[model samples]
Target: MHNIVLFGPPGAGKGTQSQKLIAQYNLVHLSTGDLLRAQITEGTALGLKAKKLMDEGLLVPDEVVIGMIGSALSANQQAAGFIFDGFPRTTAQAESLDRLLAEHHTKVACMIALEVGEEELVKRLLERGKTSGRPDDQDETKIRRRVTVYNTETAQVAGYYAAQHKFHALNGIGNIDDIFAQICLLIDQHKPAVDEAPAAATREVKA
Candidate 1:
């Protein structure tokens, strides 16, 4: 599979670009937040477990999240590929994801990150808040905190992928179509030539 781990801080246009990429590539959207909500809506055991932890003001364990991802992979055996969003927040989670995908005889095609200046992100988010009705977006302090959290915590995950020659970064301040075109270029360059072939595991990917 030509799986992708799409990364960006808030207001970086990830949502807009992801929609285009998904439709263009016919990739499954494996957003962890959405998956967690699915589990809760379905009343599954894992979902119940996650919801309980969330209600208790505790973070749900990685295993539960991985379990949800594993189930998703199993259920979508026929998917062209998967686009992972809001997952693998740590290097440890990245390692775990590698192991899980290896079990399925497929691997992540690339990790694409959208790079934007913190000030621009803050401006964009605050503007969005005016229309989005999300109080968190309206608060500059909270917005900065979120950006700092991404830099200190989630950003480290990029290194794990980079060490494997699977990381790509792009400037996010550009025309929407221009940015997406660049992202597509990178994915096409790195994506396995044979998506479903058994030999995909050993395919050479361009850095």
Candidate 2:
């Protein structure tokens, strides 16, 4: 499996890029935010617990999120691979994800990071806020805080992947298709080569 970790700050268009990658790779999409929000919208006990923390821009507990991911991996065993979005946002979570993938007999092939400046992120998120109706995006203070938190808490996760030689960073300021093309190039480079077919036995020939 050619699993990938779609890494980037908020408003870096990770979600948008993930859709493109999924189409290209036939990979399953796994977003921790989406998973938690699904439970929240369903009013499950876990949802109630995550809602408050999520609204305040805090990450949900590693164990809780990991449990959900485990379930997802099991359900999607037939997937070619998975693109992890909004997950492994912390070093602890990254370690847990490694263990989980090992159990599934697959590993992250690469972490493709979309690099965008803080101001650009703020600008993009504010524009998104106008239509998204997410309170966290509506507040500039919260947005900046989220960025800061990402830098402080999530950026370290890059080191974990980098140590394993599986991190790739790209400029996120460009045409959407161009960015996707660049990302695909990187993915292509990292993709594992398939085994070649065995050669047929040669028959004796007249000399």
Candidate 3:
């Protein structure tokens, strides 16, 4: 089972890219925000707890996030793979993901980090505020806080994965298709070689 992570700052188009990647690669797209919102909307037990924390402006606990992801993964075992959009932000969550995927006999194949300038991120987020209707997104102060938290808390995981040779950074300023193409190239490079093609080519050349 192939597993991938798309890491980027807010407004870097991670969600946009993830949707394209899922369609092109047949991978399941797992967005933590979507999952949590669904849980809350459904009034699940975890959702109730998460809603309380969110209502109070507190981050949801890691265990709750992990449980949600674990449930998603198990239910989608028949998927081609999974593309995690915003789940494993902290190192603890990252490690937990590693363990959970291992238990399922799968592993993270790549972590695609979309690099964008902070100024641009702030600009995009502010514009997003006008349309998102999310209280956190609508508040500039809260948006900045999320960015700061991501830099301090989540950015470190990029280096952690890089040390393990699983990190790939892509410039995120171009057109949506351009960024998606870059990611597609990386995934192609990581895919195992097809033996059938090599064998056929060898025979044709011999003839």
Candidate 4:
């Protein structure tokens, strides 16, 4: 399996690149933010809990987030692999994810970290807020707080993956296609090769 974690702060183009990577690799795209929104829209019990926290401008608990991811994994049993976006934001979450994947006899192939400057991130997010209709993005203070929180809290997740030799940092400022090509090169290096159908068939016949 060629599981990947697409890591970055807000406005780092993780979402855009995730779409392209999914199409190119036939991988299941798992965005935790999207998953949580789905639960909220569906009015699940977990969603109710998450909603209360979100309304208070607090993060949903790690266990709740992990539960959602577990459910997603169960649903996509036959996927080629998964491209995980907006997840494993903490070292604990990273550890949990590793354990969960190990249960399926697969491990993360790599974590592609998008490195973007704080000022550029702020500019992109503020511009996006104009059209995104997201209150959090609209406020300069909130945007900087989110970035600061990422740096102080979530950035350590990179070290967790790095210790396993599964972290790759790429510059996030460039032509989209050029950046994607660089990411693909890294993925291709780590993704396991699929067995050739003809070769497998021949072996079965000989057997």
Would you list the rank order by TM-score, best first?
A: 1, 4, 2, 3
- TM-score of each candidate structure, all chains considered together: 0.93, 0.82, 0.81, 0.84
lDDT for every model? 0.87, 0.80, 0.77, 0.81
User: Which residue pairs in candidate 2 collide?
Assistant: none
Q: Which scores greater on lDDT, model 1 or model 3?
A: 1
Rank candidates by lDDT, best first: 1, 4, 2, 3
What tens-digit string does per-residue lDDT give for candidate 1 at 1-207? Answer: 889999999999999998898877878788898889889988999999999999999999999999999998887777778888988889989989999999988889999999899999999999999999999999999999999998776569888898999999999999999999999999999888777732112211110
What alpha-carbon RMSD in Å does predicted model 2 have with respect to the real structure?
Answer: 10.6
Of candidates 4 and 2, the better by TM-score:
4
Candidate 4: segments with Cα more than 4 A from true spot: 43-59, 194-207
Top TM-score model: 1
The regions of model 3 sitting more than 4 angstroms off are 43-45, 48-58, 135-139, 192-207
Per-residue CA lDDT of model 3 for 30-147, tens digit only, reads 7888888888888888899999999999999988888788878776666667788776877788899998888776778888888888778888988888898877877778877877
lDDT winner, 1 or 4? 1
Which stretches of model 1 miss by more than 4 angstroms? 197-207
Better of 1 and 4 by TM-score: 1
